[model samples]
Target: MTDVLVLTERELRAAVSLDLDAVDVVERAFAGLGAGGVVMPPILSMAIEERHAEVDVKTAYVPGLDGFAIKVSPGFFDNPKRGLPSLNGMMIVLSAETGIVQAALLDNGYLTDVRTAAAGAVAARHLAPATVRRAGVLGAGLQAELQIRALALVRTVPEVLVWARDPAKARAYTERMAASLSIPVRVADSPEAVVRGCDVVVTTTPSRTPLIEAGWLHPGLHVTAMGSDAPDKNELAPAVLARADRFVCDRRSQSAVLGELRSAIATGAVPEDWPVDELGEIVAGTKPGRRSADEITVCDLTGTGVQDTAIATHALRVARASGAGHVVEN
Candidate 1:
């Protein structure tokens, strides 16, 4: 018989919040990835164009981990019109040796939010300038708020700029984050303003067209573009890659197909044989990051399955230690 820990969203939240610990867990996973021998497959994505929704399946196996995880994440862009949230999903963990179910983390995308935001923090930690007084975000949704919070853990942020197509959402996000993060969060007049006004910028929107242009990139700027996890979505113009002094991808292979890199490659901005550095390689120190303070660095993160497995494993361990979930025997 095997015992499976079943955790609800609240229980998992009690176990794993979006903190520096979460950032370290994802960072370690990246280190393992950079060291090699980690088996992370391509993302399985299904887009229902009719409803403006997508379902993504991602999974991975790290060499030293006791269990691997498979995560199913769905985003229904129109859900907000229905007065519901857009993102919701869960993860399942299986033992590395026996292939038995270890836990059912019914987090409803909470873990994904944390891990994704943590990846942003990791990007800022290694790539952003030494001092970041102002941070800028392109979206006013969950990820925008979390990314700022995560960046604060790595850098001191006294001010933040946010821009969304919907002015109401941007204003609401500004007010809420200002009160919560104890920092000034203001609504930017435009995407250009957000990019130009801050040293570090994160784009979290679902825009099909480019929200950021190449001309806005400045010296000592760090941009983390995480919104384009699909073939049809893009946030940064292809030339943005050309303008960047240093470009980093979460996974070169995956980014070449599904992330912003693909768009850049298609438009002839970045060569097919450009030879870029993966975030893992930089994290592992096998590759360099931001050689000089004047370099404009960009990180393309499509999100990886190793991160899912890593965070799921970490959350499960914490849940057990804190007695947060119910165990089911099968």
Candidate 2:
């Protein structure tokens, strides 16, 4: 039997903190895909609609890591009334070699948030201008906070601007994240303000409409669109995508179906020949990220199975070392 490494949300957090190696693991997973050593199957998801809310069950298999992660997250409607997170989920990691049970992670959506945010950081590290000094985030939800923390790990950002529909929540998030990271956080009045001034902009909303406009983005700015991971979800305007010098994604197949590229493609704003390269291509030196300092770059990430496997594997290693998970005899 494979040693199952069950990890809790707290343990996952501790694991990410204690190890910079987790980032490397995730990076290599992408690089492996670019080098043709990995196979990331399409994500299969189903939505259960309710009168009050809906829940989504998603499964993805990553062949490079020889594992898969299954997740279930609920809609945002019941958050206030239930005193629970709008998103609720867990990931079950399995051994790819034998398809045996390996570990179950009760991350409560925390691991997903971190792994997705880490993807943004990876994108920024590759695509952002070398002189990047300021960052902006659109959306003040759970993922937004983690994006700030993750981006801090890569660039020397001294100031970060946050914008949310709710002024109070934005302020609170700014205060809390700023205190924790020792960086200056500012609250922006509009999404345009956040995109206009920052060298790196991250969008983590659940909006189906465009939040960042094309005109607001300056030359050399790097935008990470982490909001739209599913069909009918979009954050960046089609015009913004059309203006980018480089439009990169975690996976071309998924992004063509669900990411902002989907909207761009549907509107005919982006040409059929437009090459939407994968981040792995850049990591593998198969393609260059930023052609020039003034190139406008966009990294559209829909979260990949490879990322889940990397995080789950790292969490397992950490849990084993820290004696955090329980073992069972079967």
Clashes of each: 0, 0
Tell me the lDDT of candidate 2: 0.80
User: lDDT tens digits, residues 1-330, model 2?
Assistant: 446667778777776651246567777778777778565667666555554566655554555565666665556666768786667678887777777877888888777776787777788778988876789998888778877777777778889999998999999998898788888899999998888889899999889999988888788899999989888999998988888888899998888888999989889989866777899899888999788989999999988877777777777766778888767644
Candidate 2 lDDT trough over 10 residues, lowest sum = 15-24
User: Residue-wise lDDT of candidate 1 within 195-269, one digit each (tens)?
Assistant: 999999999998899999999999999999998887888999999998999889899988888788998999999
The alpha-carbon deviation from the true structure for residue 197 of candidate 1, after best TM-score superposition, in angstroms, is 1.3
> What RMSD, rounded to one decimal, does every model reach?
1.3, 2.2
Looking at model 1, the pairs that clash are none
Runs of candidate 1 with Cα error greater than 4 angstroms are 48-52
lDDT of each: 0.92, 0.80
List of clashing residue pairs for candidate 2: none
Q: In model 2, which runs have C-alpha deviations exceeding 4 angstroms? A: 1-3, 51-68, 72-76
Model 1: lDDT of residue 231: 80
Name the candidate that leads on TM-score. 1
